[model samples]
Structures are given as structure tokens and as C-alpha cells.
Target chain A: MSNVIEVKNLTKSYKEIKALNDLSFEVTEGEILGLLGPNGSGKSTTINCILSLLKYDEGSITVFGKDMKPDSYDIKAKLGVVFQDVAVFDELTVYENIDYFCGLYIKDKATRKKYVEEAIDLVSLSEFKKFYPKKLSGGLLRRLNIACGIAHKPKLIFLDEPTVAVDPQSRNSILEGIMKLRDMGATIVYTTHYMEEVEMICDRVIIIDKGHVLASGTTDELKRLAKIDEKIIVEANSFDSKYIEEIKSFKAVHSADYKERVLTVSYKEGADNLVKIIEYLKKNHIKYSRVYSERPTLNDVFLELTGKELRD
Target chain B: MFVHNFKYSLKALFRNKTLIFWTLMFPIILGTFFKMAFSNVTSSEAFKAINFAVVEDDNFKNDEVFVTVIKELSDEDGDNRIFDTTYVENEDEAKELLVDGKIDGYLVMPDKKDDTPGVTFINNGINQTIIKNVVEEIALNEKIGNEIGETIVKDEMAKGNFNIDIDGIYEKVMEKMSDETNLLDKSANKLDYSMIEFYTLIAMTCIYGGMLSIASINNSLANISQKGKRVSVAPTRKLVTVLSSLLASYVIQLVGLALLFVYTIFALNIDYGDNIAKVILLGAVGSLAGLAMGLFVGTVFKAGENAKTGILIAITMFFCNFAGMFGITMKYITDTKMPWLTKINPVGLITDGLYALYYYNTTDRFSADIINLIILTLVLTAVSFFSIRRRRYDSI
Candidate 1:
């Protein structure tokens, strides 16, 4: 498969902070690559380096086999950028905004008109075409940002946290849009802090932290790499930390956490772990309100790989 | 791509309210100010204010002629206005008053030297040339009128045509000549009044153009503020962007100048002059100078709206002040010898061009005005070129 983007030994720094350290990545045509990282984990830095928006100390970045610069019109002509901040001309209405963005790419008025309408339809913004960006809700504005970015139907796209601060409904629609773009054969590199989004749509995921790639694979594959198998949580009025540790002595229980008058027991590759936890709770005479048992998820994988402590 | 960029500039020009106001309305307001201040100069009143002050000296042979001429020149009902008059003590006092804003000009006469009498006039005025004309005409009238009055008195004494009362005959002839003097001043001043206005209008136009240039370039540079971010991703080079943007603003400025001309010439019937072409040329040159100045400011510093607009106003005001916008700024200006700075100054050049075209004939100096415009345009272009080149959009 032909790779749509290629970055080799991409290293970038700002003063003393190393934003990207010898990063290497590629996205094949028609594939969706999710770049998952916590906040300030060099995700944006990587994307910016790839886009040539920021100069890098040491690296080579190519899109469609050509170098990029401010005057790289040939490559930039096919480029589409949708900043997370929702950038659109305030003076222009929704339709004009899309038309103007599209106009930048496609000058033919009729062709631009068709593409703008298609973009509006793609974002489900037909009803709000006449409204200004300020008049639209956050969801509609986000959609408008998407429409403006993708109206020219670029072959390669970098959707940087497109669903940040969006409502659940808008999130679903954005996810659906990503899927539709992927099906339409655009190679997309999506970065987001939301691991659930990575699992939902990404064909492949690379998780990075502190300017270094930690783990990269499919969701299930990543889950397998993490040692913890299943996590069990029990909300109780009061639980002794020592009793939770005693539950950890169970052969299947890999680890246990007790805090805020509740107990969470993580088991290693086991099915009857929740039942065992409940019995242990009852025998201990701990009054529990509710219980949940779930297999290892991408979020669990994320925390396990990047430590459970809060990052600055 | 260039065409779209041009269209984008047009869209920006039309839609951006602040840009529109600065480019179009600002100049109109400025022009209205010029029109109000210069309204008197353009009307019939320009003739009446063309006065000369005569200082009475001790060694004068014709003291009676000086006082009688003054009295005759003054219209009885109309403040005895004869191109307006002022009587002062001596040359120093007359000129001091003229300089001190008490009179337009003062005429000095040396004691009658057999055939070589000297008259010196100091001008404190709007129409110095007109004041000079009044002084010269009065001097000529008194010299020849006195000669003829004395001749007629002697003829009446020798011919015995009447009772030979020499003083009475002199008075009658003087009265007759005084009536003629009044007629001559009235006709001459009325006929030549527009010349003064023509020069004033040219100066005012230059002021307007200079000020508007600053505003136009400022607004043009400001137009690029938002697009500064887009430059990184845009297809066109920064050179193209700046050039195209400046060119677009140049067009808007031309429109502003046209509006001024229309308001003055067509709407208000203020005759700009016979040389309409020169006026147009001056407007174009002045606008270019303003545009270049704006570019200089834009490229000099990373400016916001207030500072950007401020620099524009300041530069235009600076240049316009030198352009003699009100005839007051350059009143005491004694640098007429080196007309290069005044002539090479874009405002000065345009004002000079307009003045020549309106009042005088199309001389070589008018053509040299083109050279002045060329130099100014080149200077501004170099400044703008360097500015745009040095203007880095790194991480902006």
C-alpha cells in the first residue's frame, strides 16, 4: 500500500523542552491512524512538525512525496487544516465560509458551489448554511469547521482533536464523519486524548507520552500487552484497606485499590473474579451499593502505560 | 490564484467596515474640512481681501497723494474697501502689523528721489502675489496720475480756460483719477481673484491626498492583519500579497480623491482649474506617497489597529502640514529657494502641480512635477519593498 504521509527521525524542540524526539510514523492510503496521547504528550508537536507549520531541528517530513514550506503551494493546495479552536471567517456566513475555504482550493465557481453544498451536506449543516458562525451552537460550529476543512476533499487529513469539548451527540456525528471519510478513501491521522474514540474508529493506534511512543497496535492487541486483565469495582459504605489487600491474595487478583470507602479489585485473566469479590465483601460484612466488572479497556491500557498519577 | 487574491482583497475592502471607513469616509471628512476652511477663498470674497498697507515716511514728496489715494480707495459704505486697506506709521510698524496678523501687507515709500522713488511692501497675507499687485498698481497710478494732474493744473493756468485756481483744478483732476483708481482696483481684483483660490485649492488637495495616503496605507496594512496567519498556508508569496493589497488600497484611495474632486468641482461648482489632468496626476502621486508611508509604518513595527491608524494620521498630518493645507502652516516658511524639498515632497509636488495647472499655464515645472512624483513613488516603493521583505510571519 502506498503511504500517504511519511515522517523519519522527526525531532523538534522548543528552548529546553523536547517536543518530539526522533519520532517516526507513516499512514497508508485509505487507513485511519489514531495518535493517542495525554495532554502535552507531543501529539500536537508531531502533527505540527509533519505539517511543516513549525520548524524542526532534525527531521524529514513528506506528504504525497514532496517537501513542505510556506511557498509549497503544490503540496499545500491539496492540504486541509481544521484547527481544534474552530477557525472560520466571522464575516462570512456558514455557506460563504465553506465556499471561501473551498474557493481557496477550487476556483471554478460552479465546482466550488457543488463542493460547498456537498460539504454542508456531509456535515449535516444544510439547515444552518445561512447562519453566521457566532449564531450557531458549538456543535454546529464544529461541523462548520469540518466542512470548511474538508470541502476540497483532500486525500490526506490530520484531524487534531476534532471532537474536543463537543457534546456526545456531536461526538457521534464527528465519529461518523471520520468513518465516512475513511470509507471514501482519505488517509486520516486523528489525535485525541479520548481513548474511546481511538478504539471506536482507528484501524491502528499509536500511544505516545513524553515525546516517546510507548505502545502501538490495535485496541485488543494493546489490551493484551497490559498485564492487568479485568478490573472489578464495588461501591461500599466502608472498606478496610487491609481487607482489599487480603482480596489481592486471591490467586486471580493481580492488584486491588481501596479508597473513598470503596474497593476496586483488578484480576489477571479470570471470569469468577467479580463473584469472589462479592463473597469476600459479604463475608467481611461490608454494605455495598453497586458493583461493576469489565474487561481491560483502552482507557485501562492508557493508564497502565502512562502511569496512574496526574500529569502536569 | 492572483485573481482570487484580488477578489479576496476586494471582498475584504467592501466587507471590512473599519477598512471601508478609513479608505472612503475618512478622506471625505478630511476634504469637507478643507472645503470649510477654504470656502472663502473659492468665493467672490477672495477679491476683497487682496489689500496693501502703505506706511507713510517723512521724505515723501507726495504726502497728500498717499493720504488722498487711501481715502479714495476706501469705498464709503463698504468700509471704503479697495482690495481692502490699512494705514500704519512707517515701514517697520506696517510690516510688524502685517507680520503680527493685523494686515495682509505693508507698502513702504522712500523719500522722492528725483526719478528713482523706492516703494517696499512687506506681506502678511494669504494672497502675497495679489497684495504685491495692489501695491504696484497703486504706485503706478499715483506716479502717472500725479504727473498728469500737475500737467492739467499747469495747462489750466497757462491756457486761461478758467479762473486759474491751481489747487482747485488739481483736486478736480485728482477726484477724477481717484474714481478711475476705484474702478481699476475693482475690475482687476475681480478678474484675478480665482488665481489665489486656485493655488489654495491645490495646496488643500495635496493635504487631503497626503493625509489620505497615510490612512489608506494604514488600512491596507490592517487588512493583512487577519490574513497574516493564512500567509503560511496560502499559495501566493508574501510579495504578491503585499503588492496586491497595496494596489487594491491604491484603487480605493483613487476613488476617495475622485469623490473629493466631484464634491468640489461638480457638486459645489468649485472650479479646480483649467488643467484637470494635472490635478488628477497630483492626486495619483499624492495617494502613492501616502500608500508608501503606510507600508513603512506597517513594516516598521508589529502594529495593532490604534497604533497603525495613529502612525498613518501622524505621517499624513506631518506631510500635509508641509503641504500648506491652510496656507498658514507654510506662511512664514522661507525655504522657497530650495523648492526641491517642497517640490520633491509628494504633498508639495502635488500641491505645486495643482497650483500651476489651476492658476498658471502648463509649464515645464508642471512636467517636472512628474519627475518629482516618480522620485517620491520610487522612494515609497523601495520602503514598501524592504518592509514587506523584512516583515517575517514566523509563528505569527
Candidate 2:
């Protein structure tokens, strides 16, 4: 696939703190590239640098094969950005707001009307078209914000934590709308703190921390990097620490812990690992209600690569 | 792109109740207050014939010139009249009227050889002054014309032409007494000092254009507002957006100014000038200058939104106060003591332009003030644009 955005050696500093340090990444066309990072990890700064909204100390950013600059309207015309904040006019109705923003990119009246209506439908804000932003609920307001950004139907879009503080339903609808946008042949660069959102909607993910990208790959590929072959959970009426210790001695077991009425065993790598754990439990007569086995999720990969350190 | 930006900007600003209130409705409300407060003042200051009582005594009957002068001065006809004269039966009645404040003053005819007929007043004031001046001028005319008539009569008698009708001669003298000069020249001067208050109010209203320009700048620059970020990232050039938004501001301000002008000129009954077009032109330029000043403030300062708005209002009102919104003489003091401030101050410039239109006979001063305001507008607009040109925020 062709690359829509490329960044090389991006560095940004603010007074005494470094925001982005030699960060590099590329977003290929026709895919949702999730930029996953904890708070204050240069995700917003990176997106701002790529959008030419901020000047970096050292960087080269190109969008659609052109060096991105503040005056790069040609490149910006095909780009849409939905900031993390709910940026919209409170005085304008939903339709008027969408029309005003859509008019920014599409000048033709008829085409703009069609696109505005389509966007209103895409976000499912048809009923609230005539309502002012202040009168709408939080979820409806968020949908209106999205409609404003994507109404022009730009080829590349940047959604900076679009689902932050949103309810589950709205977040799901937003994710579905974003997927629909991608299916319509647009490249999306999504940023969020939610790891599941990245795993659910992102075709590829970049895990970053401390102004550095620790790893980047598809969800399954990134999970493999965690090196956790299986996670086995056993629900039991009673669990003994001796049993946990015994499970920990197994050659395939990486770690074992028992909490409440359940016991969990993480295996490093082994085929039939679940079977071995089940046979051992049956032989020890460790009564269990349910047992399940699963592979490591994308969050496990994130925690493994970025380290489970608290960031401010 | 410009049209789209301008249209949306107009819509947004119109919907902004705060802007609408301050720009359009507040000025009208203040004007109503000014009208109510100044109406009585104008009425009290209007020129009306003074009232006086004359003592009808033997000395007064002998003084034919005084009698005729009073007759002509207090005639029933509105024209060529200065006093509403009443002849009293005695000095007690005249004094009673004077003390009772029914008449402004009383006139007494000369009774003794050393006595001269003169005016008396209850107190020294504008009405008393008017009555005193008119009575004094009549006394002087009688004295001068009496001497001239005596000389003419003696010369005619010496030439043995004594059948010249001396009474007719005296009447002619009275007729030609004050014909060479008029007491009050009301032909050329049209300035009513009370109207300066309204002009200053209009001047203050014009400066309210700052609100619109500040809104424009705030809505177009990324660091100023969230809407600014969207505007910055739009496909349209930033310059186009800024200028179009400014044009929208100018239109809205001009409309507000026009409303103020119409209200003050017609509804409030204040005379701005006879040249309506020129007055409107000066006001338009003043609004532009005011808008530019606000844009300059918005672009040059990175203050918060409310802070910037407060600064704009405070600064404009400061200049307006100096331009005499509070007192008419303040403008004169500022003009004389700190003439450069008057030249540089936008509100002062607009107030002076309107003042010149009202008081000055020629358009020279008005044109100069207009030019200065236009230059100020251009300079401020240039500085504002220079400050905002391709500006990229370190963070937003």
C-alpha cells in the first residue's frame, strides 16, 4: 500500500521538557493506524507536527508527498482533523455548523449540501440537525463534531482521541463510523489511550512511550511479541497457595497466582498447555467450576513493550 | 472562499447576543437616556422673550424716547421684539412683580435732574443678563441719537430752516438708532453646545466597532479560539479568511453606526451636519479605524478572550472619555493640553471630525480629520495583519 504520511526524526521540546524525541512513523493508505500511548507521551504533539499546527525543533513531515507547512493548503484540503476537544460553535445549529465547516472545503453549493446531509446521516444526527450544540447531549454533540470534521470527505483524516470521555454507545458508533470511513477508501490516523479500541478498529498499531515508538505491528503480531503463549483461568470454590506453588513449578508455567475463588496460570510457550494444566488440576482433585484458555491481548503487548510504568 | 467565510461570519456575529447588545442595543439605550436627560436642558436654554415691568409715572410720560423704545421693543409682533413689557401703576407694583419673580427686572424712568432711567434686576443670571443688555443698548441709543438730533436741529435753526417737524425728526432718529449693527448675530453660527453630548455618544458608539473586529480576530486565529483552529486548517488561505471576516465585521459595525446616526440625528433631534453623505462617510471611516484598532489589540496580545475583550472596551472607553463623553470641555482640554493625543486617539479623531462638520464653515478640517482616521485605520490594519501573518503557535 502507498504511504499517505511519513515522518522522520521528529523532535519537539517545550522549555525544559522534550515532547517528541526523534519519533518516526508512517501511515499507509487505506488503513486505520492507531497511535497508542499513555498521557503525555507525545501522541498529540506528533499529530500536531504532522498537521503543521505546531513547529518542531527537528523534523521532516510529508503528507501526500508534499512537505507539510502551515501554508500547505493543498495538502490540508484533502486532510480532516477532529481534535481531542469537542471543537464546535455553540451558536450554530448542527446543520449550519456542518454546512459552515463543509463549505470550508467544498465550495459548490449542491455538492456541499449533499455531502452535509450524508455526513449528518453518517453520524446519525439527522434528528438533531436543527438543534444548537449546547442543547444536545454529550454523545450527540460528539457525533456532530465528527460530522463537521469529515463532512468534506477528505482522503486522509486525523482523529485525536475522538472517543475520550464518551459513553460506550457513542464510542462504538464512532468506531463503526471510522471503519466505514476507511472502507470508503480513506486513510485514518486514530489516537487514543484505550488499548481495546486500538485492537478492535486499528488495522495496525504503534505503541509509544517517552517520545519513542517501542513497537509497531498488526494486533496479533504485536501480541506475539509479548511471548505469552497462553493465559489459563480456573474458577474454583477454593484455591490453595500450595496448589498455586505447585503449578508455578511446572516447566511451561511462567507465573501462577490465585485470587478470590479463581486461579490463573500464565504459560511461556507450549502446545497442549491447557490440557496439561487441566490434567494436573484433575489429578490433584482441585475442584473447579470453569476453565478457559486464551492468548495474550494487544494490551499485554503494550504493557510488555512500553513497560507498566505510571506516566503523568 | 471569501464569500463563504464572510457569510458564516456574519451569521455567527449576528447570532452572538452579546455582540448585538453592546454594538446595537446598548448604544440605543444610552441614547435614549441622553435624550431624556438633555431634552429639558435644551428647552430651558432656548431663546424666549424676556419679561419686564415699567413704572408708569410722570417722569416716564415725559421721556418720549423711553416710551417709544419700550413700545417698539415690547411690541406684540414676534419679530423686532426683545421684552414682554408691562406698565405698572406705581413703583411698588413694579417692585412687587420683580420680587415675586413674575418679571425678570423692572424699568424706571428718570424723575430728577440727576436721575437717569435704568434697569434693575433681582439677581445676576443669564435671563437678567439678557434683559440688562437690551435695556442698556436702548439707553445708549437714546443718548447718542438725542445728541445727534439736537445738533441737526440747531444746525437747521441756524440756517433758518426751522419748519422741519422736530417730532418727525426725533422719530427718524429712533428709527435709525440700532440699524447699523444687530445685537445678536444668529445667521452664520449653528452650533448648539448641548448637542456635543450626543456627538460624543455617537463617537463612543463608533468605537464599539472594536467588539466586532475582536470577535473576527478571535474566530480566525488558532491560538485565540477553537473555531480559529478549524479556520486555520481549512482549505482557504488564512489571509482570505482573516480579511473576509474583517469585512464582515466592518459591515456589521457600519450598520450599527448607521442606526446610531439615524437615531441621534432624527429621533434625538441633534444636528450632526447638513452634509449627510459626508457625515456618514466620516462615521464609516471611524468605524473602520475602530475595527482596526481592535484587531490590533487582539492580534498583538495573547491574553485570554475575556481579557482581550475587556481591554478593548476599556481602552476605547478611555479614549472616548478623553473625547468628552463625560463633559464637553474635556475634548477641548485634551485638544489643547495634549494635542498629539487628539491626533492619535481614534475616538478623538472621530469626535473632532463630527465636531468640525457641525461647527466649522468649511470642510477642510473635517476632511483632514477623516484622512487622519483613514491613515490610522490602514496603519492599525497593517500592524494587525503583520502580527497574524502565518503565525504558528508553539502549542494550542
Q: Pick the candidate with the highest lDDT.
A: 2
lDDT of 1 by residue, B80-168 (tens): 35546666666777667766776666666655533433434354334564454344455555666677777887787688776677777
Supply candidate 2's per-residue lDDT for B166: 72
Interface RMSD of each: 3.7, 1.2
- Chain A TM per candidate, in order of listing: 0.94, 0.94
Q: What TM-score against the true fold does each predicted structure earn?
A: 0.69, 0.75
Query: Across residues B1-396, which tens digit of lDDT does each residue of candidate 2 receive?
Result: 999989989988888889899889888999899888877776677656678899988888887767876777676663556678889988899989999988989888776723656778766554564455455555555666777788778888999996988787876665555443233221212325556667767777777878888988898888788778877888778889888998998899988988887887778877876677888888888888888888988899889767887898899889978887777667756764698899888888888788766644346667889989988889998888888875566887
Q: Candidates' DockQ values?
A: 0.17, 0.45
How would you encode candidate 1's per-residue C-alpha lDDT over A1-312 as one tens digit per residue? 887788888877777888788888777888889998888888877776666656788878888887766457788777676666676666578998787667767878888889899989888999998897889989888888888788988887778888878899998998998899889888889988888899899999999888878988888889898788888988888776788668878997788887886677888787787787778777878788999898888998898898888876
Best by TM-score: 2
Clashing residue pairs, candidate 1? B74-B80, B75-B80, B75-B81, B213-B290
**Candidate 1 CAPRI level:** incorrect
Candidate 1 overall lDDT versus native = 0.67
Model 2 off-target regions past 4 Å? Answer: A227-295, A307-309, B40-192
